[model samples]
Target: MKFTERLWQDIAPIYNSILKHGFVNELMAGSLPTFLFQYYIQQDALYLADFSRALNLLAARSIRTDDVLQFTQFAQNAILVERALHETYFSIYAIEPATQKMPACFAYTNYLLATTSLQSIAVGAAAVLPCFWIYRQVGKHIYQQALQENPYRTWIDTYAGEAFDVSVNQMLAITDRLAEQAGAAERQQMQDAFRISSQLEWYFWNDAYTQNQWQV
Candidate 1:
């Protein structure tokens, strides 16, 4: 089996858990409180700033110019396309984001940046793939029950739509190609990064559902 396929099987339970996550259920039902969604989007905006940096770092480390350019464009999309959704949410909700990152948001982004810097470009890429890939899956799942008047419809549509699917497919291809050349140990490390980030994906929504606030 392909490494990415195996990695997904390993995290099957977590992926399933995400589909049942409260935030998602609430979102599809059109009952998620606006305040909680606001909190999630705000931290997401802060989170993407660092995410784009992680992508940029991988681009800088790329031995292949095409890889470099691809990563650079992915980095730009993180800010330009995805974060634009958050910016629109900010306007609709009329809430100013915290000047600081929320706890869960900080942990996930820092882990991605640090891992990518310390590990292979492949591992770095693996670390960040879940954010893109999982959200595409989540968006597809949630859109099934999305009401036309759903307050979060824009966010849902952004992820569930074709353009986002194209991005996810590109990232998956990149990971599989990296996996093709990786040794067993490095492959395991890449899977570890993927799994950890996947789990963090769940925790992010859970944290938002509970509206986790910074203690300080």
Candidate 2:
């Protein structure tokens, strides 16, 4: 079977949990979850922009072809996708994209770019994996709630649909493929980067909640 098919297989448990409880059920039913959702919407755009800029800077430097190509492609796609959704997210907060900046967001973004520029492509790819995986997990969780409520039908349906599955599956497939191609050193770098980025993601969302003055 294709890597994507296998990835979906591997992620089945987490995916199902997200579909069944996290997105839809846990999200809308809990005040904390709603605030968390709003926080992410208000903050992710700036972080994404930082991520994009980092990728572009890496592309400007000398790097090995294969890994760089894969990461670059992913990062570029991320920029375009983020931009596509920015307007909708921004409208929710009555905020414009030009009006936001967080130091941590910049630091994370710069770290990613610097990693891609100075380290192996495997390292860069690993750094980005947490973001993709968490997104899939969160979307699945939120969708479950939306479906349960039958409100926010578009958001619920979008998360519940094949498009989200396809995107998450694609990232996992890439990770699997890269893991096979990477050597021990590269793998270690990737692992460390993944852990760090995952933590950063958590903090990023936490900051959103705090900064937004959201109750709960």
On TM-score, the candidate that comes out on top is 1
Weakest ten-residue segment in model 1 by summed lDDT: 95-104
lDDT of each: 0.90, 0.59
Where model 1 places Cα greater than 4 Å from the true spot, the runs are none
What is candidate 2's lDDT per residue for 1-216, written digit by digit as tens? 643344345445544544444333544554434455555555677677767665555455525575457456656766776665656645654654444555556567777877767776556666766667766667666665443544344444554567656765665766677668878777666767776776666556546555533244
**Consecutive 10-residue window with the lowest summed lDDT within model 2:** 17-26
- Residue pairs with colliding backbones in model 2 are 22-141, 23-141, 23-142, 23-145, 24-141, 24-144, 24-145, 24-146, 25-145
Q: TM-score of the candidate numbered 2? A: 0.68
Q: Which pairs clash (backbone N, Cα, C closer than 3 Å) in model 1? A: none
RMSD for each of the candidates: 1.0, 5.5
